[model samples]
Target: MFAGVDIGGTTTQVLLCTADLAVIDSTEVSTPAREGGQAMVRAALDALSVLRARVPSRLLGIGIGAAGVVDSRAGRILVASDSFRSWAGFEVTATVEKALGVPAFLDNDVNAFLRGEAAKGAVVDEPYVLGMTLGTGVGGALRLNGELLDGPHGAAGEVGHIPGFGDLPCTCGGRGHLETLASGRSIRARYGERTGRLLTARGVAEAAADGDPDALAVYEAAGAGVARAILITAGLLDITTVVVGGGVSRAWDLIQPPMLAELTAGPPVSGHPIRVVRARLGSGAVAIGAASRARTELDAVTRV
Candidate 1:
């Protein structure tokens, strides 16, 4: 058995899986985002204990998918969003290993999301791909030749922070980032700016579904921004296969038309048509991907 944990800003999910990564049991807990790293880990530990109690197999190892720039080699979070207090610089894998008495591995949450899709979800078995997650914030990851690439600074596929989308300020203190145009929070803010009503992203989607021109325009702009980012990635990396996920992607009906239009308008120089699809694993992707990572690491250690 192996344990997979995904620690998000609002919730922490834990999954117990077999050697092949089939989930045997799972649980979730509210994350103490403002309370500090130790509290958040404790919440994950508590949920993990519940799952472990339900499963009879001995856990072989653990893998953690956390929201931040992770140093996979060091099993630590190098940088995190402002939503998490004291998350950056947290010794995640070490602390979890000490608490659970097992070998552990860690990676950025977006990386894990892409790995999950490549392993068993939408882009299963694909060699080269780009993954985007448009939640409260946007995140990205790259997979090439069947392996995820984590650059020296662990920010190789950080497409959200790249500038030139618009003049809006990003949560990372940058201006003209893709996140400002495509993230869930940004969608809501954009809609609120158009009409003085502050609606949630979901509400805006609902309004768009009802043919509200303002809402439609907002989603179209977001789709265009996303398309531009995808095009930039394709041109740079020669990766035309893209998979999108996260809360904002739920409004695929509202976002896809303009995105496809933009992609069609400017074909890549390589002439390869871009293929974009929604994630299939839903909210379970991170945990499953984490378990897959644990299995891979454990197998490597055994060979060594």
Candidate 2:
């Protein structure tokens, strides 16, 4: 058996899986975001302890999928969002391994999400993919030739931080980033700016469904921004297949039309129409992917 953990800003999810990555048991707990990394890890560990007690199989290893710029090679979180106090520069895998007496591996949450989709979800067997998640913030990862590229700086596929979308400020303190227009938080903020009514992204989607013109326009702009980001990625990486997931993507009915229209307006130079699809694994992608990572690494070690 292997364990997979996804440590997010608001929640921490843990899963017990078989060697092939089939989930046997799972649980979730609130992440102590402001309490520091030790508290957050304790939350995940506590849930993991509950899951471990229900299974009789010997645990082989553990894998963690965490939000931030992770240094997977070092088994540490190199940089994290401000929401997580004392998260950056923490030795995640070492701490988990010491507490649980097992080998542990760590990866960027978005990288794990992409790996999960490639292994068994939306982009299964696809050779090339660009995975994006549109939640409170936006994240991206690249999978090429069946392998994920972390790049020299571990920030290779950070598409959301790319500039030139508009003059809107980004959470990263940059001006005119894709996240300013395409993230769930951005969608809500954009709608509020137009209507003076603060609503959740879901509420804005409901308003759009009810024929609210302002809400409709806000979604359209978001869709257009996403389309532009996809085009730029397609142009540079020549990767046309994309998988998008997260909270905002639930409004696919509202976002897809404008996104498709924008894509059609400016096709990539290679003349291949970008194929964008929604993620199939839903919220469990990261955990499953982390399990898969552990399984792969353990198998490789055995062979070596």
Which residue runs of candidate 2 sit more than 4 Å off their true CA positions?
none
lDDT of candidate 2 over 40-141, digit per residue (tens):
999999999998888878999999999999999899988887889999989999999999998999989999999889887999988778999988888999
Error in Å for residue 182 of model 2: 0.9
RMSD of each: 0.8, 1.0
lDDT of 1 by residue, 1-304 (tens): 9988889999888999888777888888898999999999999999988887778789899988999899999999999989999999999989999998999999899999998888789999888899999999999999988899999999989999989987999999889999999998999999999998899999999999999999999999999999999999999999969999999999999889999999999988799899999999889889888988988988998999
Which ranges of candidate 1 are over 4 A from the true structure?
A: none
TM-score of 2: 0.98
The most accurate candidate by TM-score is: 1
